[model samples]
Target chain A: MKHNSYFDGKVQSLELHTENGVATVGVITPGQYTFGTSTQEKMVITAGSLRVKLPDQDWQTVMSGEFFVVDKNVSFVVEAEQDVAYLCYYF
Target chain B: MKHNSYFDGKVQSLELHTENGVATVGVITPGQYTFGTSTQEKMVITAGSLRVKLPDQDWQTVMSGEFFVVDKNVSFVVEAEQDVAYLCYYF
Candidate 1:
């Protein structure tokens, strides 16, 4: 797994994988972003804050210990503005 | 996201998603099993104990705060026997 940090060191892609059938975990900081395209994805916010934006202009804010799922082909953006962290897996 | 628990009353699939472009998280427990097929998958153990079994008869044990990824076309199994928990996401 690969962990990458971004956004002037405020965000991170804590884990990245090239595998197709495994589970991985990561941590994100405040003002971080997890970008998605026409593909499907799933995620959960284990701690802190998170913002999810959908193509239909619908968005949501999640705080510590909250969970959400984004369906396929829905381009979206996830961001944290206040010391947030989350865990994700790809299947 | 959906959260489910199973076991000899001891395992759980904390979260499940049908989406392809988002991230989700879940928790697992002791003596729990996460089974995979020939497809690719990724996972991380945020807390507690975890055991992973590969198709080629390879396996590994993970403890609190450890992470790992599984590649495509590789079937595997994950089991915990003593009070374990984890967080996962799909992308």
Candidate 2:
């Protein structure tokens, strides 16, 4: 497992390998943040919600048990009014 | 966010505040671990699966999207054959 903390520790993730591929379960504090992806990503909201603006798409609210996709080599924006927990799978 | 590493970093978690209560998203490396809870815990498997033995219960398989509950002050054993990511809510 790999532990990663970003945005001055406002965001943190713990990495794990599953049958789906490499995945991280992380938490984001209440704030806005931008993230760049090295591979195609599928993000699942495990707890709370997020307002996500993916590349070339309008901002959308993703709630708990919902998910969104982010393409590789692109950047996206995420805003949280409350702490959000997510599972991100890289493919 | 609070970053916690246990069992010599074999297990790691990031704490987050949620509407339901305080929660932590964590990953456990392939192994067996016993944990004692201070509060009632609801554990949801997010990435992989595990064989969990809660207090006064038989060992059972908990898969992704499945959840198990443990009473406060009880200890439980979890065995993961592969990396497992989980969301634990303390109430």
lDDT values of the candidates? 0.54, 0.93
Q: Write model 1 residue lDDT over A14-69, tens digit each, in one string.
A: 33332232333444544546566444455656655678886776778877567666
Candidate 1 chain A has its poorest 10 consecutive residues by lDDT at A14-23
Tell me the spans in candidate 2 whose CA falls farther than 4 Å from its real position: none
Candidate with the greatest lDDT versus the true structure: 2
Judged by whole-model lDDT over C-alpha atoms, candidate 1 comes out at 0.54
Worst 10 residues of 2 chain A by lDDT: A1-10
Model 1 error, position B80 (Å): 9.6
TM-score, structure 2 vs. true: 0.97
**What's the TM for model 1?**
0.44
